[model samples]
Target: MKKNLLVFFCLISVQIIVSQIRNVDGSLGRIPRRGSDSIPDNEISVKLSGKTKYTDYKIISHKNDTTIIDTTLTIQKEYKFNFLRKDNFELLEFHNQGQTFTNLGYDFTNISPFPDIGFRAKMFNYFHIEDVNYYQVPTPTTEIMYRTGMEQGQVLDALFTTNFSKRFNVALAYKGIRSLGKYRRSLASTGNFRVSFRYETPKGQYTIKGHAANQDFFHQENGGLTPTALEAFINDDPNFNSNRARMDVNLSNAESTLDAKRLYFEHTFKLLSSKDSVTQKDFSNLKLGHSFTRDSKFFRFNQGAPTTGVFGEVITSSGIDDKTAYIAYNNELFLDFNSKYVLGKFRVKTMLSNYRYGYENLQNSTVGITKNKLKGNAVSLGADWNGRIGNFHINASGMLTPGSGRLSGNSFKGEAFYKKDSVFTIKSNVEISNRFPNFNFLLHQSSYDAYNWENNFVQEGTRTLGGSIASKWGDASIALTNISNYTYFDENSKPVQFSGDVNYLKLKVSKEFSVGKFALDNTVMYQKVANGDSVFRVPEIVTRNTLYYTDEWFKGNPLLVQIGTTFKYFTKYKANAYDPLLAEFRLQNETEIGYPTVDVFFNARVRRTRIYFKADNISSFVLKKNYFSAPNYPYRDFVIRFGLVWNWFI
Candidate 1:
């Protein structure tokens, strides 16, 4: 069966490549312009992943060119690929976007808003600045957006981009978020800033591109609600009422903070060039480039008193103070080729990196005062290929480290996608990777009982095969994954490595129906685990349904509004518990969590301003109050939130 699957994919890939070549003659090789003039004012080109070459792919807006205030806000369709929902800008949510404290699912990592840490948080997707999008704006462009949540939560974002000349451009972006949760000691705050520049010599022979960024994350840890408090709240105790602040928590005076800084620069000089008849400009055929990056991260956890009981006994003499720092420097040299014959691009690069990671526990006498450190150097080679034929696109990349350092490993990722002009699309992806355990999971020491671990673990290997199909009706996707030597925190909140292999299969489906101005959208996910349910736990079924009415109102249809109520539910299962000290979710068998949650929201747009009002947990009055997002962690209670986003151009 495996051999046949491989053969089938290979044959499909070959067919796609052949078809692309055969249709190349009739292809325009450029995205169609939407305006009457040669250059569309609403058209903007984008290049991601630090690619130096220009492509015809562009993001075009349909709004007319006018003052920023004249622009109208448009509702964004919710993503259907994931089962997560968006809660108010705060912590304690069941698999939600923007909110913290959720299951990792197939991510195979912890949930922390630190960019320097090996773990990835859902919020990181909102702060990632690696992808660069160049705009062809004739004038300066600036956008400012702000959103306010219930309690004291707020989010602000600002962006400015402009070109000094046809060959030089720069962009700056800033995002800030602060959320004071309804529960005590559950505040979360983050700030991210980035500045990037792209420059090209007048002759288009030499180019320089770079970006510098800083990110900071802060959150107060409230080690789950006490069992007594949870029971009282669930039974509708009058003393607690609906106020979460009165609920007793395990930890009342603890905070976690992370700070990170990054600088990346790449410069390329063309070795060969040819004139393009279509654009009347010189394009680089072969280029030599060098890239450099410096990244540093610091994490600190402070507690007013030593943590004890439940998790374990802490043998510490003083208050808890734990710190971890990581610094890495990377340099790479590469050669890039832009093929003129096959209409493809390829690049090969070699990189050298120096990484240093360490930690210090101030209150733990057993670990001493001296810091524990680990440092190493790694050398690796990587290559990437991207091409298009007809309406199909293919991208593939691979990297390997020849056992030169502790981080020695190999990874391969590839994807093929075909689109048939508003009809349907099909995409397939495969990935194989071998990666070392995260530094924190391998060696960590702290004054808290659940915060100390030391182990020499083997590298973890993973393979995933996925495919998706999308059309006007809906979309569906399936993924099959296998993991070997899986490392996770066990039921005891202790780091453990599973020696056996684990397999997972996931399926997602989304469908939409409309009647007049009313619409019903549903997303469902089903997951199956083989041989690892004890370690890897997930709800068997997760579903979200949204029913809403969208329409235009006011004179000249200037105001657009959408009122919707969302219902999310999951099957009962032994959900994993979270470790506040380690910022990781671990397997647990003592408690099972599964509940139905409902939220009502009203969103509107006026000109270039978008506004949102949401009432979460609206059905708490009727549903069982014993609901929990994770074991021992009571989900947020009923709450109302309001926010807005506004864009401006100058």
Candidate 2:
């Protein structure tokens, strides 16, 4: 099989090269130039720019962007998609995607505190207010994407954009997801909307970019299953066989919801410009800009029947209603300098910012209800630089808050990378920061007994050094980190600050091999604690493997298909427990969980449309039912799901 696959790969490579050579002398290889009166009827020339991270907004013929159609069709294409098969890009991580509620394998070195209203479970699905993109579409363009799950789960995403003139454009996008789990009290839903606009003067001396976004996330907290019920279900007790809803849960009538709204605008004017010889457009060498941002968040938790046994003793009524709200405002002024001074283009930005955050929380007590308000202000100076030297690129940025405020601290980050043609690349990064604890961790009050806390915790300081190498074969990376004054929830479910320093090391590697039409890909990660395993526990090893076959079907190769299976396993370890009232995973020594899981999938793409069909946990019938993603929380059962995504340009 291996020899056959290798020979097939070689043949395909040769065929592709020959096809490229043949097309080089034909009009098929030429990109249609702008301002052409006669454009290809089937071709669409697009310049996409908005969210710069996902896309660079470069002008390109639609036929050349294969990733938009190819990558989306495969489940094994990206590591993030394997963990959480959700449309919101939220990795189904055991830990690390957000905060450390549980001792899951999260890289604390990369965690940062953001001002939030305290609801966390669903925040992973919320679209970031700062990452909204502005679009420039020549004609009205619309894209609709829909997906269906095994249960009553569905996801719908829509986007529309149009240009009123060549100089101005506007876009609107909305995404909604609802997944009703087979387990009790495990329903999740999210709704997100964004509107953005971009405008530039005909002379290209002035420009404006702005966007507004709103997001809401709702979740039902089951507090996991009971130990007795789990054991019975694993033992194939006749009462609960194949009946998930019959299992006993810790909580049944609790819900957590969060809503956020944000508005941002930035305007820039060129102070100096030079004519670009190649593009024949004015290039701004020095630019002045001002930006304003306002963000508001609200969180609410309701329990129809508060169970004191599951969530500590409650000081409020049997039925509880708790709410928290926060608002933040930021103003910034910056100067940007961009030019080709030496070997490559150099860019630098220096900025001054003023920030304000205020919050109000409704606390319940035996006597009645109380409202608490807290506010803080900070002023910071920041700067960033990016430049290239030969085939290497470097970027560095830092910010310092000198005045007296809750956010008075300094952060520094730097990275450098070198690419050797297209064969391989090496990169290194370093980060040092002093950050305050989250507002909720500092002061929070709720109706549940274990959900209230108030303490003055010092700043947490972290330093990390990491490096990675990527080549045609695979990628490898390592990181070393040290943290001081770590804050976390203790075994007692109370917030505590660890004064001692903790050191950690993590290493990861991934590789892919292809033989003919068969491909095998594997990834493994190892984490070691030099000092603090009691506080920060993680599995020693985690591994994932995928084996697949790929081929083209039908005439003209219009259909590309891949059939594959994925296996993921992690070493058993003492995973942390979760606290529903706090919407947090806390330290626990009661149960340790780690298990192996398997999934099979078929993916195909036809032109601009992609289809996916998957059966997750296919080995559940043969494997032990003790498989748990977190303590007491059984992983999903064997289920089939199908979905499709389509992009249209009109």
Candidate 3:
């Protein structure tokens, strides 16, 4: 125990010294001019200095120039390790990206202020920097857009678990699915099964697990139409697309673990089949290979002051047949301490890691964020302080990473809440931080997305900070926000000159109540963008109410009905002509748009049988939009949906 504590402090001290001795300066990024002229830095990529690591890299070029630079930055490093030796860490692991690399690129057009279910969650709005692409032609003014941003998908899943003894249990599961939804070329059709058995012992548990899945992506062209910016080009160009690279994988893992009152040890092994045959060329954006990894860890007590642990994981990738090029091994070491009293009011936990990124596909975007621009590797060290007083809780953390030629910046965020009464409450938060570009924008020089008809490219917008507040009294609630507020630089070395700052503010209020047996809820909101524009967009105001009544006379059954509609307003400019590099000063009046949608449902039960019928978008609203959602197409009109759900298993 004493030796463990001594090592913990030693590692912390060494980390502090290394952080101080680091040599670096703020990195300079690039922002292209709005119009046709290209203003690239001496180095193709100005944002990443020559000394950054553990991030994506890129060639910040323009429609007219494509130059290579000395360094690209690795701004963000996150390692999610499993606490147990047999645990392997991965989020939504082993996802099948379909038949192409479309899932490998930037997908920004989805945030067109349109009510999209899939695009909202990937949280695409977090990054918006420069634009890069090939212009087939321009676009023309349209009277209306139709059936915009449509997607389809289907999946099947099953599971089973059993325990033969007090110390042993076996579990198995299988999944099958197919989908042409979400991002471009972002489709999937896959099948996979896994089985694991664990045994508990006095000292620890012994376990073995294995699994494999295969996925194929569809390469469909002329599948849709796209919209453009130029009036001349809009009429002359056809929005056609092709698939680039194909991706597939076979994966399996094994691990052993030991757990005791004072010590813990674990070891893990993982293998992935990454080599894919390139029979077709959608574009020369991606190359496939094989990746193998091993991870291990240990945790011990140090005189009982606190728990201390050390961990490491390494990975290697190789080309199957052609050794023209491959990936090298990368590793990281983590040091941890807990329950350590710091500053009298806080308990501190610190960690540090060094690792390299695996390979990824790139994109071909001419006017938006992409993954091709992000690529690099580096060491990461962070500290988390926990503090509490009465009903108040506070925390603070920061990181300084060096990648390419620049020192990637850090961020600080915190939140608080209070309750004044049983029915009233108040909450607020002050968060300031920088968000790096998406994975595709910084790494992998190959195609990432393809199904949607977009080529892959790099994204280079970083540095974002903001805050928000909310309060509730009686049956009413109000909120104020400045979610995206900051001055940003592009991948170039120059500052972006906008008509104004990239700042926005919002105000909202809502009330919840019920009339007799019907419960009702309501809300409304308004926002003002920094560009002197007031737009009503996204997750808009709506009211929903459910009427309930007991029909005990009908075999102890109940009758319930739900009705709801959402109202929202916003506007997007569809210029007779537009420059992908610049935004023309030609503005349009606010469009008082109305999306009155409704949902109705019925539920009934009789003994062991229960039934449900639901209807959505009863108004049959078709999609409408002016942005280049796919390639040169816009969503138009309203649509409707109806379905029945049955519960057969509990």
Candidate 4:
């Protein structure tokens, strides 16, 4: 299967290359432009004739922010061209492409006010509703992104969008990956498919948008190397240094899978409009809105045979299979009011939510018979405010559920910002949330005797205040948080909550310097645990630096090239250990693994296509082989790979 997919993609790539060569002077290889007329960077104009500008293609975020399509090549693009298709500065990836990541840092500023199905280790590659994107374009647009995988497979993401009429648009996208890792029982495969649509009435009185998605993730678990195999790996034994498959693993026949599907829609109708043509009317544009969402998820773990030494005794040694499922529905109705007195817009809303999460039937083990499910409904009241005063813009939202139910809690997030041109900007934000622990923490059932549990945990609460500044000099941010009833997995792979308050502080800064055709980009982060370090742990410092040279090559500026190398390092600390059975990370103090890595890259751009070539972890060849992503799990070795991203408009 892996070889077939590789061959298919290679054939398509060759076909596209040939087409580009044949149509360099035609539409296929021509860049989007606004004719030969040049417009000043500070000027804004609308042209009804000639070719369409890149700004005509728009991407709308879940929060209503909009940005135009960008086809430029830069260092930032290099950082984001990965399996996740995003910048992973705060994360450390495992050995394979579709596997999990270890959190180098945490962000508590934006958290949900409701509990979910646990097993966070399996959610790194999963896509939530907020990750989906909508699009609007004057012409049919398509984008294809491909990347080589770790050992035997690759990753591909394709997107297409088009407008049927002046007021209607639709988009379809899919991303799939398969990688047979170098280690035994480490294969990973995943797929994500989504479709989105948007429509508006000709009078601009009604607007509607929605999306549906289906996703699945599957991976084999080996439970890392055994004690003897670990010693040989760290000692740099020449016999097994080049061939990693020869190493012995703890588990040989265990696998885990996660599946999810969602359907969502939101619509708005304007009840009233302005009385005159004035921009600032006393009262104008009253709107009524409704939003609906239904999502379902399932997780399963299977083992043909159990290892008593690794996972403890089991109720039945024949085989083990564990499954958990979750389903939720949310309906929100809101009224929006726009008035000159209020400066901007205000919204009042109420949400009705229903949830069911747990096992399907009762399981009787040596421990006891555990509860099957936690099902209930909740009603929440919410308010949102957005306004601008002089040079400052303020936005805030709050939601509350008064009763003493499992979903009973309150959440609030507010932000204020000031900007003076594009050179200087400052922002401040605050967040507060109180919610119950995940379903697995409250109730769980498994074939293993030690994995079944039932508990009544209290609601966890957290508060945070943060501020950031961005100017021509650089960018900097600082945040401090206080957490109470912090829930986590203990070293024994059991759910536990901290009783005392945990205080944490984080500071980060980034800057770039350029001289001639060379530039250096640096980003550094510092973290400190003021109290309760046992339950909450993080590295003291993490940093990444890149030095690169860029220039236009060839005569007619047919190509643009960038050559660079990046170095990343972090301080050693008590990192967490991963548990495959529950797909969770447990707190541990036994292993402290931290080291520096170097990666070299040569990237170039031609027309609307961007090519990437990278040699990752070159430092591993010269340094000691003591690096580990987690306890007993070694980091990946040196490898070279290449791929490309291309865009087409019709």
Q: Tens digit of lDDT per residue, candidate 2, span 21-58? A: 32323422322322233544234443332111212222
lDDT of each: 0.67, 0.67, 0.26, 0.86
602: Cα error in model 4, Å: 0.7
User: Model 3's lDDT to the true fold?
Assistant: 0.26
Give TM per candidate.
0.83, 0.84, 0.42, 0.94
lDDT of 3 by residue, 1-650 (tens): 23323333443454344234322454323322112134323312223234222111212222113342121111000011100101111011111212211011111211221011111112211111122111110110001001111145433333333344434444343333344533243343433333434343433222222222221112222112222222322242233211211111111111111111111112222211122256432211111211122221111111111111111111112211100012212232222222212321221222232223222332224324343222234444444454555455555555444444212434454545555445444555444443343221222221112111212222222222223333443233233333232222232211222332343444445554556645444444443444323221222232333333323333322322333333322232221111111111112232222333344444343321223333433433333222222222222213332222111110
Q: Stretches of candidate 4 above 4 Å error?
A: 1-50, 280-284
Prediction 4 global C-alpha lDDT: 0.86
The candidate with the higher TM-score, 3 or 4, is 4
Order of all candidates by TM-score, from best down to worst? Answer: 4, 2, 1, 3
**Candidate 1 clash figure, as a count:** 1
Error of 2 at 478 (Å): 1.3
Between candidates 2 and 4, the one scoring higher on lDDT is 4
Kindly give the stretch of ten consecutive residues in candidate 3 with the minimal lDDT sum. Answer: 137-146
Residues 482-531 of candidate 4 have per-residue lDDT tens digits of: 99999999998899999899999999999999999999999999999999
Tens-place lDDT per residue, model 1, 323-348, is: 88889888999998886555688889
Model 1 scores a C-alpha lDDT of 0.67
- Model 4: residue 120 alpha-carbon error in angstroms: 0.7
Note each model's CA RMSD in angstroms. 12.0, 9.4, 26.3, 3.8
